[model samples]
Target: MDPEALNPVIDKAVESGIPVVMFDADAPNSKAYAFLGTNNYYAGVTAADKMAELLNEAGGEVGVVTHPNQLNHKERTEGFRETIEKEYPKMTVVDVKDGRGDQMISKEVSEELMREYPNIKGIFASEANGGVGVGKAVIDQQKKGGDIHIISFDTDKGTLDMINDGIISATMAQGTWKMGYWSLQFLFHLQHDIAGELEGETNLPRYVDTGITVVTKDNVNEYYPGE
Candidate 1:
């Protein structure tokens, strides 16, 4: 969706005394009350660190699969790339390709990437579908749980399963429940003028870092539902 298109709607909602908060994806230019979601850039940095560790600091070529134009994905990709370049000098980003947030497309693109850059040692998947797709590509190529490591985003069931099977090395898990709960709290505060109770502060924080965790085989069982 066009960020510009959202500006008018967000402005109208604010003008009508309705509170708006964006999560997962953001429109920084919008007049929403706040953004409550993962610190996508930092999550990307986390992925970089995990990927480096999985490669045992002996860095090699890595590829990225992500939504190319979305704001959150863009930030994540940027963070991963920048961190790799600055801190892991031995690692290089061989290519970045759009996954379109679809499993099949991601798999196809990942397969192409693997074929093109056979020396690629790792891949950072910026979303769940992309992560699973990358895993499938690796498996199809008979490289699953082998030299190519994968660091992915989110803890969807498929991603977790892949991690369990050693097809994916790790994943960045977001605080999804916190995003929902805090978004409501912020909206309630705005609607009820709760901030007026504060001595000096009258505005909610513009951005909230919902936080992220690296999920790996050692703790993968903990992330399962009800575990």
Candidate 2:
């Protein structure tokens, strides 16, 4: 199951001995056997480094927003925060809002942040929905889109448009297809001994590093919808 978005639901299933495999995000505490997803922390770290490279001199205030209390969001934010603080102390993270994966709510939160932090020069979003939501908010304000330098996650429809239109800066594309594919594969292997599992390999790889790539205006066509 795609536990990245909903940990508790998957955790519950895992506790009940249901063959659950995670994706995109993880559930370490849950008894789930295996996880098939990206190293979200590293993804966050890479995003921060890219932002620093893109806006080294234009640093003012950066913000990160995500769905309220999501596991993947939490990990992404943690990585982003840790990397930014450790490497680019000049850039500061000002406000963090919970968009709840809702467009209206994300819009409202982004608008409020803009009003509150006029110096917000850049933004990093932890998920596809939050990225598009913040992008829409910035566009509605008629602000200089390129100047904000947004870095987002996933490849949703709105996010793709924002990247293409230069409303957002870049996005980290995750192996979502792998998330689905491996989750099922691992579950099947666990159920059947066709492969004859090795001894001493009791637990699954505590963490699986799926993979990620940065999508930007320069190479946006490489990730056009349906491509």
Candidate 3:
């Protein structure tokens, strides 16, 4: 949806004295009270560090698969590229392709990327669908268990399965539960004017870092329900 379409909705809500807290994806131009979700940039940094470890610091070209136009994905891609340049001189981000947050499209793009850069040693997928798609491409090309490493974001069932199957090396697990909990809490406080009770404070933090964790083979099972 066009982001501009949300401007009036947000304005209407705020005009009606309703508090809006964005999570996962943000509309910065809107009058939302706050954005509560993972620090996407740091999540990318974490993916870079994990990729470096998986690559044993030897370094090789890496590609990024993500939603290029989305704010959160852009930040993640930027963070990953910046960290690679700053901390891992040998690692280079060779390409960035828009996955459109779809499995089939990401798979197609990953196939093209692999063909274009056979020397590509790693890939960072900034979202779950892209992660699963990249893993599928790797598996189809018989690159699984090979030198190519994949680091992705989120712990969706498919991504977790890929990690367990040794297709994806690791993934950054966002604090989705916390995002929901805190978003509601913030809205409640705003509805009740809870912050007004405090001395001179009338608003919640404009942004919150929900958090992230690197999910790898060693602890992948722990992330599942009733595990």
lDDT of 1 by residue, 168-218 (tens): 999999999999999889888888888564454447888899999999999
Better of 1 and 3 by TM-score: 1
Sequence-dependent TM-score of model 1? 0.94
C-alpha lDDT of candidate 3 relative to the true structure:
0.89
lDDT, candidate 1, at 91: 96
lDDT of 2 by residue, 91-151 (tens): 8888788888776777788888878887777788888888888888888776543346788
lDDT agreement with native, every candidate = 0.89, 0.77, 0.89
Q: TM-score for every candidate vs. truth?
A: 0.94, 0.84, 0.93
Model 3 ranges off by over 4 Å: 1-4, 143-146, 197-201
lDDT of 3 by residue, 119-153 (tens): 89999999999999999899877744446789998
Better TM-score candidate (1, 2): 1
* Candidate with maximal TM-score: 1
Clash pairs (backbone) in predicted model 2: none
For model 3 the local lDDT of residue 199 reads 62
